[model samples]
Target: MRRAEYHCAAHHPRDWVEDTGAEVAFSGRSNVGKSSAVNAITGRKGLARTSKTPGRTQQIIFFNLDETRRLVDLPGYGYAKVPVQLQQHWEKTVRRYLEERVSLRALILPVDCRREPTVLDWQLLKWCAASQLPVHVLLTKSDKLGHGKSLQALRQTRESLATMPLVSVQLFSATRNVGVTEARERIVDLLSGQGNGRKPA
Candidate 1:
């Protein structure tokens, strides 16, 4: 539909946590194309700036939509250059938010199609499983793989994370618009409380 209304709601470091209602979080490894996916989904260039350095998004950035919805871009995990203390702080912050935030509706975990699930991904999934929060796996950059390889990758991912409860697993290519419509519709439906089908875990 219309490009969902968006605006910068708040920027919070590990200290100042601002509460937003019914927010959806985007989480992934460092430079796993989370920002690119955000820009693609919103159809706004630079809405979520792409960074050359991994772990550049060191703070939680919240983008408010129509003053009703919030799209949260969480700091990427497993970035090496950042200091250990900062990394620990981010981990704590993200974990606290995920566990405590009542307005959070879902967590969208983006994984690069070329890479297998990392330990960080497993940890995130484990946290979601413990919390019983809805999780979705978005296999980004699907065009990077051949058709057979892409399907294999998706299957492998599903198999590897068999224990985690995921809402859905979808092939997504922001560059090719492969699953953009379906992803968007699914997300919208979920946000509206319509798509309650428990997707394959």
Candidate 2:
């Protein structure tokens, strides 16, 4: 474990932690292994709750790395079973956070390895590009595929988003602890403002 602890949960901007220092956020669709990736990266099992059910994470949850650094878990998107009004609220809230939070360093986007990126995923990537926010894509559940398939998925993702200079893609499998070290290093670089993507305007 990397000494991570729950910091806070925010339902709105007023509920967000003080915008200072640097923090990296995890965003993904429901049931996409976002929580698994967080736990793997931190070396702390169960640090973020994992569930088979969709729409479990309803608020923006924050985990503290230290007083000056943090990890944010944004609400899962693209769950149709969730009420439409609530979904709309989440969309508005997430967009505001992405655009306005100064402490937000980068976004970690987890996509299922078996399929192409969802439309909502592309929307987020484009949004990050417009804001110059660096994004790291984790092809989660990669252990389900053979080595060749995993590599192919990674290459395809990279090729599809080649025009987006700030977006990077890598194969990841929380069950096998794949790419955890690389993910951690990339996060550190982003927090230290060393990533290629520029800060949002």
Candidate 3:
């Protein structure tokens, strides 16, 4: 498996890296433990920068696993104190990247296991489905709940998205290291061109 290292950061469409090689994007609502999960996956403590305040990271940070594979830390949505127009711009930026980036192979979505998918999360799912893109979801922060609750969350998430042929869900906990190995294996496969375990729906 490729060990990810800090690569580059892009805040606007014009600044994005060259559109070559494969990329897998990580995204979620603010404070979804996304930064933590990303850190755990890459074995880099400060690589993704865990935020004390949600939605403060305003740019897409890229981490390279190799010359041809990257992990994209997309700016968190849904809880920043920024102006409405800025939020809209961020949304547009993320959507445009997702839609137009030819090398983007998969998405790694982190949703708080304690709650249902946020509106932005749903919008992303719908958009990826329409784009025939593959997605893998992490029911993040599962350690906050009991094992039964965690399993239930995973099951419910799977059930809710069962109709989506290229989507898969798994429980994750950055704090306790739960599901870390599984997530890494899956990600390695995705970055290796195996993709999300199926063809588009």
Please report the candidate that would top TM-score against the real structure.
2
Task: Look at candidate 1 and give me any clashing residue pairs.
Answer: none
Model 1, runs deviating above 4 Å: 1-20, 196-201
- Per-residue CA lDDT of model 2 for 1-201, tens digit only, reads 298888888898899999998899999999999888989999989799989999999999999998788899999999999999999999999989998889999999999999999999999999899888899999999999999999999999999999999998888999998999999999888887887844432
lDDT of 1 at 142: 99
RMSD of 3: 2.3
lDDT of 1 by residue, 1-201 (tens): 245444543334434335544667899999998888787777776788788789888778776665556678889998888899889888888877887776777788899988987998988788787776677788999999999999998898888777765456888988897787777776665555455522222
**Per-residue C-alpha lDDT of model 3 across residues 89-199, encoded as one tens digit per residue:** 888899899878887888899999999998889988988888778888999889899999889888989999998988888888888888889999888787666855322
Ten-residue segment with the worst summed lDDT in candidate 1?
A: 192-201
- The candidate that wins on lDDT is 2
Better of 1 and 3 by lDDT: 3
lDDT per prediction? 0.76, 0.91, 0.84
Q: TM-score for every candidate vs. truth?
A: 0.87, 0.96, 0.93
Q: What is the lDDT of residue 91 in candidate 2?
A: 91
lDDT score for residue 151 of model 1: 97
Indicate the worst ten consecutive residues by lDDT in candidate 2: 192-201
Ranking by TM-score: 2, 3, 1
Model 2 reaches what TM-score against the true structure?
0.96
